[model samples]
Every structure is written in structure tokens, then in C-alpha cells.
Target: MTALLAAWCLCCSLAFASSYPLIKSKPNDTGSNLLHEGHNNTGMADRCSDRGFNAITLDDKGVMYYFRDQYVWKGYIGPAELINDTWPEVPVPVDAAFRIHHRNKPEVHERMFLFKGNKAWAYYENKLEPGYPKLITDVFPGVPGDLDSALECPAGECKSDSVLFFKGKSVYTYDLSDPSAVKERQWPLVQNCTAAVRWLGKHYCFQDTMFTRFNPVTGEVHPGYPLDTRDYFISCPGRGHGHETRRNATLMSIKNRCSNRSFEAFTSDDSGKTYGFRGGWYFRMDSKRDGWHAWSIGSTWKGLKGTVDAAFNWENKMYFIQGSQVTIFLSDQIYSMVQGYPKPLQDELGMQQVDAAFTCPHSSDLYIIKGNTLSLVDLKNTPRVPGQESSIIHSNVDSAMCNSQGVHIFTGASFHRYKDPNELLQAKELPEARNIAAEFLDCTQ
Candidate 1:
């Protein structure tokens, strides 16, 4: 099995290299065309220096579109255009948004509504559409008048039968199982419904109350086991089960109350019913002057059924640069955990700060970013037995995306793809990847 796996990995590496056709490099000045007429400022030039002026996305049909924020300076909706591959200048509205949030499946048609004061606005397709961001009475029949508190709400379909919406203190559920589509509200059930995941036909919610599982259709909380609530706010949940589920679903909770208190990170098998506490870790500022920091944690988070094995840590503090290297907190320290044991398996990485991280459909491969650079890690490489070091995939670029089939990294404006074991082995050759795989090191430097 070991030899076969090694051979399979080798072929995958070659295939990864061959997936993209090499193109000639153009002068870095190509991005300047998209700049505003009077923006001759060097600061603006610096922003487009290393960064490509436009972002690209491949649709289900494999058609690539280039997007740019025309209103980036005005603090308004940035319009994106479907620039032709041949004519990159002709812009069209592919989508528009005041801000964009990245996720594994950030469909253009899907909308995220944020409550601002008494009103709400829907952020979708890269623009804020004119409409009530809250659940309308038309969508949820017989909503209470008192519930008209203009709260920010984001709704998603957990499964065919389960639809969930995150409000302030409550997460409401709508059951599509019935022909009539009855809406059932479960408020104040999970203290903070910041992040949620659906597994085994059940929905898990994480917030101030730790984690809890609910029947997607009935909105009933699970009976046995509740999540560890030692901390008031559990940030991420379901770390190792990303592809199998959604969101890392990894839960981070405050363990104590020191100004810089240690925290615990864990994953749940019984939906959110029970969580296996990994260990304690802390977040620290990366540099005193930069005010950037990194998060470091122990290998306490695990996978469902405790079958997949992996370990995780942040590689660097989040930072961004425009004209000059400006230190900005792009993301919190990252935490990773994997599936399998003894040998490398699969893994998932979660951003401690930003809402962007890559999750494979059902595979253990995970990726996260700091600024523009991307890093890959595998949970399968770690031993299931205690006290073992796991392997991680690393790259020099910014940002990465992955599915069950393979992983892709975004360097400059282009993307590079890699297959598993081979990708893992190739990653092992690089210095950054090797450093990340070494014993847990603090990135707060």
C-alpha cells in the first residue's frame, strides 16, 4: 500500500505541473490601464504593483471572468466586468458589491445581508441590492411583530429540507420537508450563531453557548452531549471535517479570563453535541511595531469518528501592502487539524480572523492564506497515535483554493494546481513547507 501510494503521488505531481499551459510574461505595466484618469499618485501605482488589477473566477462551465472594483475609492459598490480573454479592457457587470466575502462556494446569486442600524442591505453578486436584508414576511409566514427588530441576518440551505438563518441571539430554521414549507424559529438556542455546519443530516451551531446540534427540519436541539462551553465565544467549528461538511466547524472557546487568556480548540463528532477538547493555545502580536500577530495552538482538534488524522498551525501574521508593505491584520492566526492517524491523511485550515479559508468536499486537504500567499496542509500525514508530527503543504504565493480532486494556489494573477501525495511530497521539498511541518513554532515573530 505504501509503494502504491507513493507511485500514485508521483504521477499526481507531474499531472499538476502539466495542468496549466505556460504563457509569456507581460510587462508589469498591464494593470495601469484600469486605473482612474487622474490617479497618477504613486500610492495607487504601488497597490497595483505586485497585485493584478483584476481578479479572475472560473465558472461551472470553465469560463473565466475578470473583476475589478471601479468604485474602490468612493466606498461604493465596486462593479465587476466579464472582460473578454482577448480584450481585457471591455468591462461588463459580472457582479458588484460594497465588499466581498470569500468562501468555498460563494455563488454569485447568493446574498449576504448585513444589518446597519434600523435598515439592512443585501450584499450579493459584488453589489448591494436595493431591498430589505431581513427575512420578509412573504418568505416566513406569520413572523412575530416583535421579531421585527432590524437585525442582520444571513440565510443558507443546510440541506434540501433544512434552511437556516443567523440573527443576533437566535438561529431560525425553515423546514422544506413539508409541501407547505413551514418556518420554525429557534431563537437564543445557540448563544452566538456566528458559524454553523451541517453533518449527517444534522445542523451544528457554534457561538457563545459552545456547540449544539439541531434537527434541520424540526429545529429541535440534540438530546445527548452538548459542546464544551468553558468559553463564552467559540470562534471556529468543525476543523477536520471541511470537505465532508462545510466550514471547518472547528470550535475555539476561551478557557480562562486573563487579558491574554489561553483558549481551547476542538471539533465535534455528534454534530455540536459533544466536543473533544484538544489543548490550550494563545494569540500574540506578530511584531510590536507592525501590530500584526499570529495564533498558535496545540493539536487538540480532531475529525468525525476520530478516523482522519492531521495537525495545524499558522505560518505567519496577516499583512498587506499597497505602495509599501503596510502591516494590517488580514487574518487571525490559523488552526488546522486533520483526519486519519499514524500516517498522513487529510486536514483543514481555518482563519482566526478573516472569513476566507478553503475546504475540500470530502478530502483532508486544506488551505488558508496570509495576505496574498497561500499554504497547504494535509491531515493524513500525521499519526493517529499520540505525540506525532504531521506534514503541511506550503507555497510562496497569496491565497489558495481546493476541492476533493486537488488544490490550487493563486500567485500573482495566475493559479497553479497540484494533486495529493505528489503535491504533498513536492511541498516537502520547499523550505517554507518544511518549516511549517517542523515542530509547532510561534509565528508571532
Candidate 2:
């Protein structure tokens, strides 16, 4: 009876230890007010009221396309365009329920495709043609089975390749070798293959919550590496084959279970050969208060780096968002020896959840797409002296596109043609530009 009582007391102590403090601060404490305000501020609540944007699609040339449901729209931004500038809106080929699977670059023209119900259709654009994108092929060949996911690999110098599609647990490799003759070869029984990417010189497939690097050249599946199935979300930021070297190529996985709320970061040293957990970040929320913390490899949870809700790494720099503020760090240096991250990048962009952020593949500028706006900051554009203000380009945008050509901003449905800063500035006078800016500015409020 005495031992039982002691065990109950210990359990209660642990529960109390993890509980949020009832009274965070005194009533008249100014410091308390600041803390309260910081915690209360959650960017434009409406932007995060729902998932800001569902999917971001980019073409080989780096044209960015995105879809927003609140307004019910789909559009693309050209490489040279700014987000706030006007761009042409492409009507959804079928009905409103359809979504884009992948955009393919075949020969000299680009094509957009969508998956509807259990079928996929390809859109074609011809410089001198009058017809709209025609339904090219019904790639799936089974009883109303859903078209799971798809990706396209641009044709390299000597190898003429095409897009790859996955359905159920199997993958089909399409040959765009001849735009006139597109062929698909099925590799059957690729169990639980939720995601697949053409990486290194092989086709890396993710199945059973694990990664299997398959050699397209040899048609053999290599041994699989185990991954935390709890965190199934993954992102691949590069293209097929030789481009692997130039790609920082990191995969981000987040576990959203109420009890197991944590995020994991994984990177490839040599194209998915080995994946080690960089660390895990967690957020705890109860009725009254919420707090964030992190744990590095082999370290206790008490040794946290910082409190963060979301994080992404680019060009060796890790950018984390906590409430409305943003913080940056040289991940290797910080995780190795530096105890803490350098001071955060000043809150110049105001309170905004990093809806989407990525380093430009062709340049050193860091591009952040939030809500309906885009902000650009150069890593090298910082002030020479420490703690001094640095210049940044803030473009009131609706969408962003980053590719080999450069970063482009979209103002409306149509991509405005601009060569230099002067042309882009003059574009604001165009009718489409004015309407888009008016619509986007209203959303900012």
C-alpha cells in the first residue's frame, strides 16, 4: 500500500512538470505584456485560417504554378516576371476538382497535365496553333483506380527521357524520347511506394515508409533504408541524374499526431545511400499555453536549439519560423559546435508564415512566398557591419517561379513580359497589373 501511494505521487509530479504554467506573468508587468503579445500575434490569421496554398508546381524553365481554393484559381509565373505583376490564368482543363500532377517539357514546347478522377490528361501549347490543350492519353489502365502521383525528368544531352507516374504500389516510366511516340513501361508490385523521384543515376522509390534506390539502367532495386513512417511527408527539390551534385537535396518529414507532434529533417550524402536524423523539433500545446523545443542527435530534449514551428534549409543555411519572426543559421556550424543560432534576420517582412521558401537554383537570392506576396533577399546583400540594416527587394506578388532562367513573380493570370527593372516598373501601368495589385493588396489586409 505504501509503494502504490509513492508510485502515484511520482506520476503526478511528472504530469505537473510537463504542464504549462497557469499564470505566466503578473498583471502589471510590462515584460508580461510583451510576451503575451508576441505569443498572441500569429501573422494574418486569415492566411493561416486554412492551408494557405495546397500545391506549388514548377516547370523545367522554372515557371511556378500554384492553386488557391478560397478564390478558386490556378496560374503560372514566368521566370522573368514578378509575383505582383500580371500573368495569364490558365483555365482548369476539366472541372474544378481536377489538380495538376506534373508539368512536362517536351522538345521545344511545354505541357501542363492534370489528374481528374482516375485519369490524367496532357495540355499542349503551340506557338501557331489555335486549339486548346487536347486530352493526349489516359495513362492509367485499371478499374477506376486513382492516379496517385507523377513527375517528369527533362531530356538531358544524350538521354531522351520523360515523366514517371505512380499508381497504387507500382511505377510506370514514360519515354518522351519521341514526342510523337510516348511509351510507358510498368514496373509492377513496388509495394506501398507512396513517393518516387529520379535521383542520382537511379530511380529512388519510397515505399513501406522506407527508401529504395532503384537503378533504371539495371532494373534492380537496391536494399532499402528505414525511415520513420510516422512522418510520411517528403519533399524532393531537384531533377533527375547529373543535376544531383548541384542540388542540396534534403527531405523534410513532419509528424502531426496530436500526441507525437514533431518534425524531422533528413539529407542525402550520396543520393539516399544513408539518411541520418539531423534532429527532431517538437511543439507542445494544451488548453492554455503552447511551447516549442528541439533535440539534436544523441542529446537530451533539455538541450534544445530553439523554439520553432516550421523550418527549411537552403544553401547550407537553415531558416526557421517562430510566430511572425524568422531565424537563419549555418546548420553545419551550429549543429557541430556553436551552441545557439546567430540572431534572427530582422522581422522586415512582418508577421508571415513561410508558406513556401526555397533558394533560387540559378542564383544565391533567397526567395520566400507567403500568402499572395513574394520577398527576395540576397545572402551576400547583407550590411558589411554587423547589426546594420540591409537592402531587400519586396515585390507585392500573387505567385513566384524559380528555375534556371531566374526568379519570376506573377501579378495576375498572365505573365507580363519584362526585361529590366525599368520595364518591370513600367508594367504596373498595364491594366492587368493594376487589377492584380488591387486584388492582392486587399488580401494583405
**Best candidate according to lDDT:** 2
Per-residue lDDT for 109-160 in model 1, tens only? 3343322222334444334455444444443443322221211111232334
Question: What local distance difference test score does each model get?
Answer: 0.28, 0.31
TM-score of each: 0.28, 0.28
How much lDDT does candidate 1 score? 0.28
Show model 1 residue runs off by greater than 4 Å. Answer: 1-110, 114-121, 124-128, 131-135, 139-145, 148-157, 161-172, 175-179, 185-445
Query: 215 in model 2: Cα distance from truth in Å?
Result: 3.0
Where is model 2 poorest over a 10-residue stretch in terms of lDDT? 1-10
